[model samples]
Target: MHPALSIIVFTTLSGLGYGLATALGTGLLDPAATATKAAHLLALALIAAGLMSSTLHLGNPQRAWRAFSQWRSSWLSREGVMAVLTFLPLAASAFLAIFESRYEPALGLAGAALSLVTVYCTAMIYASLKSVQTWHTPLTPLCYLLFALAGGFSLSTFFAAMGGGNLLLSSGLAAFFVCLAWIAKLVWRNRMNTLRPISTPETATGLGFIGKVRLFERPHINDNYLTNEMGFRVARKHAVKLAALSFGLGGIVPVALLLGLLALGAAHPAVAVGVALLAVLSHITGMLVERWLFFAEARHAVMNYYGG
Candidate 1:
């Protein structure tokens, strides 16, 4: 459950890239506009950066390609395959939008669908682990999808404002998605707060009927891989502060800014774009903190054996 920087960057960057692609694919932005070309290029850049970051987390980066062959039985493999597959349509859509200045509806839609499915596969890689009760809920995928949409829409608002396109619509949609993502996140957190631990030392040892089980000695004289990886702990007080920070910066601030921009109604394009850019920055920063917490707060079932 240790929070690896590589994976954190991968999820956040890739989610944003795919979300932006989805917005473009769904016709939220005009394909013929110069801004659309910039957006397409930006999306590809984010996706490529994220994909590269993931390889750094592997034991053997050169051998990572072998992961693609396990798609039938592994969510990780499915994610790997889907991530590669998604590039086809996304690249095609980008080419047409950039060079031809034309939006092929079918290709765009296909790319969007594949992008979302790849995100789903990423979520499932964590959610399917029965040992991690916190991530085993349906809310995991929902959170991932909603956050992607929220981040994507926020970025789109910035592009629209800068491009002098439909600022009102883009900002409005961004605000709505931000609110929804925060609500869903609050619900998920509340559930985790109240849910009983499904695995305890006594339960793990199948000796609950005898008496309370307690650790009498260290598993080893020193820390091992399992302890370092699965036995991560965070202070409850720190978690509370971080959660507040995440909600305020990622959700509430973006909503307020976008709504304020919408209310101003036809403000100078430069001012609107500036505010949109601020919102995008705040949201991405908040998401990074939230993702850090996501990994840090998890308690692996294997930890029960080690007196976690």
Candidate 2:
């Protein structure tokens, strides 16, 4: 449950990338505009950067290619396979937008669908892990999808404010998605806080019937791989503070700014652009904290043996 910097960056950046890809597929912007070109490039850049960061978490980055071969059984494999397949259509769509200044419905839509599916696959990588009770839930994928949509919409609002499309509508949609994402996140937090341990030392050792179980001594004199990776702990107080920051910055503040942008109604393009920029920055920062807490707080079932 250690929060690896590489994985955190991978998830956040890729979510935003896929979200933007989804929006672009809807033909939301004028393909001929400079903003459209910039948006297309940015989307691909974000996705590529995220995918590359993910490789950093692997023990043998060169063997990452083998991951694609296990799509039938592994969520990670499915994610890898889908991520590669997604690029074909996304590249074609980007090429059309950048070079031809036109949107191809077939390619754009295909890329968009694949982008979402890829996100789902990424979520399933964690959601499918039964050993991590915090992550083993339907809500895991739901939260991931919603956060991606929210981030993507927020980024789209910035492009829209820059004159690539309808600023008012984009801001409104961004606000709505941010609100919805936070609501789902709030529920997730509540569940995590209230969850009873499905796995404890007694259950882990199959000794509950004998009576309460407790660790009589340390597993060893020194830490091992499992302790280093899965025995992480966070103070309840710090968690409360971080969760508040995540909600306020990632959710509340962005919504306020987005709604303000909606009210501005294209009256002041420069001000709207600045506000959108702030909203985007704040949301990204908030999401980073949330992701950090996500790993820091997770209780891996394997930790039971380590007296965690």
The true-versus-predicted C-alpha distance at residue 190 of model 1, in Å, is 0.8
Segments in model 1 whose C-alpha atoms lie over 4 Å from true places: 235-237
Question: What would the per-residue lDDT of candidate 2 be over residues 45-111, giving only the tens digit for each residue?
Answer: 9999999999998888988889989888999999999999999998888899899999999889898
Candidate 2 regions with alpha-carbon error over 4 angstroms: 235-237
Return the lDDT, model 2, position 245. 92
Which 10 residues in a row give candidate 1 its minimum summed lDDT?
228-237
Question: Clashes in candidate 2: how many?
Answer: 0
Candidate 1 lDDT by residue in tens digits, 59-123: 88898989999999999999999999999999999999899988899999999899899889989
- Top lDDT model: 2
